[model samples]
Target: MLYLSSFTFPNDDMEFDFFMKIKRTCYDSFYPFKVLSRHGFERIDFEPVTILYGGNGSGKSTALNVIAERTKINRDSIYNKSNFYSDYVDMCEMHLKVDIPENSRIITSDDVFDYMLNIRNLNEGIDQKREKLFEEYLDAKYSSFQMNSIADYELLKKVNATKSKTQSRFVRNQLMGNVREYSNGESAFRYFTENIGENGLYILDEPENSLSPMRQMELMKFIEDSARFFGCQFIISTHSPFLLAMRGAKLYDLDENPVEVKRWTELKNVRTYYEFFKRYEDEF
Candidate 1:
């Protein structure tokens, strides 16, 4: 279950030494270096499920991207890479327990958004084709076939087929079915359920973004089952308490200096949710 046993980023001292040696203004900026150098976030050890918990700009996503790039895993959307991206990754180090499977991948929020967008576009195209099919059906059903040419042969076949069926049925047969069965949440969840294979490492970025509370819980169970039943490993960067609270998940508090590991209930976000709900407990 553990594909990546441990990985380490260069300490600030090392990065600072490298930074001082290089031309300060040569690249203008080394973004992740500045952010990730706040503390010596040394080694990150993985379990069946390793989670990076943080607020926005906490360097969790950056860390995931670095690991994904280092291992050359399959990824859906491109991540933000600066001129110094490789320089930063080079400074970091990783140790894998076993070979990273080719099916191992990183899934970002952009990938999920694009997946949803593509579905919408496909349905729009199908709708347009449906309108064209309506006209084609009418034409074929009422065509006065004067069979004198080869092109007419195709038309005659169409006319015969169209006349045999009702207009709606003919149009339905001609056009593709709309891809609207899944809602945004359902489709987003499907992206993970379908793309992720057994016995592979998966990295999810903000997977709870479009999911409701119930769907988030469903994803949590799915991830847990994937790791427990199948030989799958997951390293996720997320802000949702629902995902953060996954049972047996090893969580690193990226918001903390040096990135300390903590229990999910101890996270500020989970505490915030707890307090809010407790305040209105009687109403619930």
Candidate 2:
């Protein structure tokens, strides 16, 4: 789980050089020329697991997307570096030894929602097709029993009447079976657990999106187990202390000009959670 060396990107257009190493680490941003790095932070190398922490619009998601896109990791979102007033864009030359695992994949809330919607739509379409098939069978089989003038119509009705209600029932059951039963957060965590596998690099963007604190902790444990027992490597962007505090997780504060790593307890988001939890400690 350790990367033996480091690399530098000589030609990146973000007004700085990109310095990184491969050592079970994560870097928020390593634009080495910047003076005002977040929390006096600089590029960080991580342990097998890493977390990126920052506030809204602090570039946490942006950094995650960059890593995912740069590493050719499967992602739910497109990465872009648009310049003002033109279709031309800036691209980064990334350096690292990380290779994406065949079994590993990125999961986003957007991807999950779209997947569920597609399943729903597919089931609906199947229902429609089944109805049409039943009507057609009725028309073809019962045509001879009706009066000549309306024989075709009557036959279709008769055919439909003969169809086993069991067919419809089976189709309906299939449509409803195995459908997502959990809340969005629960579903997301479940999906994360299901998707991650051994010896793979997974880049997750804001995995905490739909998870409750308890679910987030569950996700944290899942990630820990995957990394420890399965040889899985993770690069995650999130503000969840539950995840950020994962044993030995490296953190990069993206709010700085140049991203850098600090202890989970030192992160602003973690501190906020700490203060809030402490305030309610007496009541509990």
Candidate 3:
């Protein structure tokens, strides 16, 4: 069920009416990265868990970024274009399903560290604010003892209660975690689990960059559960056979003239891995 579909023209060519169609009844219509000009991929069809496969510079990342920016969809792809070209970005016509949830957010390897930093900074700021408010509250209460304004007394009580709630957390911090604190592989896995919450669409770009085989499998399980139980959808771009092989994942081989779906075992990357491993089969 393709919900929304739109395309972008090259070189400020806005006259061309790119076809955008929404088919499904289960998702929002986000903008698309139009097939303005792709060398290997011919066209694209969105899927629940679409996986893009190709060698470096095959335009997989480029396409992902376009979709992300144009549709205001979650994005984790590596490369991005300048804002100057945003207006010309391909438009999206999507199957209008669920309202885009506010908690839904885009996550990328590049931003993992930055997101953690922001959380940390936000928590620190919250703490400082809480302390300052506490001091103000104390002063207000003391002033109320000498003054006779019932309104001031009420304000003082409200501020003190608010400060108490803010300081109740064991961490006394708003931001509870950081990616840098975990190993590279752990960081990636943690991000996937923590960010891919209920009923949201998540786009992952080469999530295998920092994950081990075990962790990759873990990601597969997480993805499955999220989609099955939490109403989550995924659009990923990667070369990892582990992720490509996820049950029911729709794969588009960017190496093809017109991008086409294929079984995981049939993918070039998977075949190459099979051949390489076959050589050491007897030794193992």
For each candidate in the order shown, give its overall lDDT on alpha carbons.
0.87, 0.61, 0.63
lDDT string, candidate 2, 1-284, tens digits: 53211212223333332233224235453332232233343244656787778878675555555455445566664444432201111233444565545565666667767655666677677667677765655555545554456647755554555554454553454344334455667667667777776788777878888789999899899888888888877778887878988997877777655565688888887788789989999998
lDDT of 1 by residue, 1-284 (tens): 99899988878788879878886585666867867668457779999999998888888888889889888899878667888888888888888899888899999889988999998989989988888888888887876778887877888888898879988888787677887658889888998899888999998888898899999999999999999999899999988888998999999998898789999999999999999999999998
Per-residue lDDT tens digits for candidate 3, residues 11-111, read 21231333233233463432223343444343455555778888886667666665566557655434544433454454333344455655555566687
> What is the lDDT for 104 in model 1?
93
Residue clash pairs of candidate 1: none
- Compare candidates 2 and 3 on lDDT and give the better one: 3
lDDT of 3 at 182: 58
Lowest summed lDDT across 10 adjacent residues in model 1 is found at 23-32
Best by lDDT: 1
Ranking by TM-score: 1, 2, 3
User: Over 4 Å off in model 1, which ranges?
Assistant: 24-26, 143-153
Q: Give the C-alpha miss distance for residue 197 in model 2, angstroms.
A: 1.7
lDDT of 1 at 51: 95
